[model samples]
Target: MSSLEKLTVDKRTLKRIIRELKKWKAPATVLLSLYIPPGRPISDVASLLRTEYSITDNIKLKRTRDAVQRALSSAMDRLSRMQKVPPNGLVLFCGEDMETHDFICLMFSPPEPVPVFFYRTDKWFHTEFLEEMVEHEETFGLVIVERDQATIGLLKGSRIQVLEELEGYVPGKHHKGGQSQRRFDRQIEQFVKGFYKEVAEAMNKHFLPLIEKNALKAIIVGGPGYAKQDFLEEAKEFLDYRIRQKIASELIDVAYQGPAGLRELSIKASDIIAKNKYAELVKAIEEFKRHLVRDDGLAVYGDKMVRQALEMGALKFIILDEDREDAEALAEEAKKYGTEVYFLSDGVPEAEWIKKTFKGLVGVLRFKIA
Candidate 1:
């Protein structure tokens, strides 16, 4: 897959990137971040990488420059192979450990413009950018079921991952008759109960852990007929209290079953999905507005005040317009303070308002910053 196709910048991705950054110490490592704009010539990036590599050679170090040089060459080769850049462009992170002659690349097309920059630090690998990308991610669990079958999985942005599929014995509707038919009807009811119980058990086994970890925004269940609702009634017995509480919606009127039903349900419930993802951000913006109306010290805006709050370790959280040039630096500083950081994209109305009104940065303070 192309870099754009394979790359998904989410919370897990950020965690992995941060872990790598923390472990990558100096003396034997070289880190580089390059901005490859769309339709820009590969020769430009290659030339820049070569110049940086040459500069690294002159610096005093214990390890040989061979690994760094080889890594630069590999990055250049990879760039040359790309016919054109992705829509949002690419940010390439290349690192080489001289001791092991190991080279790694973490390349992706970021949602925001990644400023063209280079850094070779003891413990930095453009993790700030990763944080910015991850702040935009929203993930949730999805369940789709019919009478006899069900599919459970995760929804990561536009991607849908099927985690498990389950099938159970569901008999047809019973017809009216005498005593013999009544006994047969009771047997069918028992079978239906068993089927619902089995489906609920599968969901409990697969989805409960995610709910317990608080990894999902919510669990959205959908299926044809009353099966979705019927399964939830059984799930209450099988699933944990926390897991049961996480069910945001139980949808009926779905046409398909299994994986196909999962995808269809995603489309049908796009609004609810979007609401779950953006609700917190929207509320935060509203709270910031309330502070503004009251002229409270608890909320501050503009790049200067936000940075001041970060320096003082007074920021509870901060929001930045995705288009802001200084967002990456602000995010890095905020991370040090253990402050929550959110990147507001242009599509969001509040984000657009902030972009026009606040010069692209805002912070909710832990206390008055006067």
Candidate 2:
């Protein structure tokens, strides 16, 4: 299957599955993880498992042999039921937790095609491949440029990473008189121009590949004073046209110029980062807040109120912080009522607000529910 294919499974569900699978453990390497890519013949996989099952007999310990064989049998049984591989692909995790003696056979038609055929026996289910499929692949380039210092970063998913920090020596303003002052001014201009080129080089190095991959959605630039504008103006000559064109139109004004400034730029560029996943989440929270401030019956929060709203079929949309104890259960319940569900990460301030003020779950009702 093509890597460009959209994931067939919901991201939340995939994440939940990964979390659940990660918790299961075995004392020995009895856990089995099987990955069958799209277009592979199920019969061939069944045969392979049968062969593996026969090979398990060579195990020295009877207990280990029994566990491995049972897992292989379970995997074969699952394949026997499937007529063919799913469009995206098939993933099966069959294992016996030796410590608990509890068995699990989980199968998934992943959100994306399984990259290759793989099988493993280990203490835990191999979920790295599935985890990759759920990762937020698209990213936004963040650039904070000032005269003396600049920071370049990437906003990927809900996290921000500082890629490079550059410092420049553009000596304090010229205080001398006549020829000396003019020379100093000329030297300062050269230093500023050189600094801008260095920033451009970093931007090109970091953002160009993302652009080529079509993963970079846009670039946001910010800084204090006219330095940002000056950098943008001079960037046309030193920066790649592709990178220049991707720069957001509304350059932000920020007080700081390093990691802190990158974050400030992110918060300020909400409008420009419209396509960003975190921005979408923040927007949803803001909408919920608006409803709450107006005292509209449409907004409901806290465990009791949100649960009641879900039960009464009044919920139109809901946002739950994934860190909540019952978040997964609430998400499942919300889905049954046809309510749209959004999962928020813990670090986002808006998400934290919902967690602290609203008990980590909030819903908008389709109609006021008394």
Clash count list over all predictions? 0, 2
lDDT leader: 2
lDDT of 2 at 289: 87
| C-alpha root-mean-square deviation, each candidate | 14.2, 10.7
Task: State candidate 1's TM-score.
Answer: 0.53
- The window of 10 residues in a row where model 2 has the poorest summed lDDT is 1-10
Local distance difference test, each candidate? 0.69, 0.83
**How much is 331 displaced in model 2, in angstroms?**
11
Model 2 clash number = 2
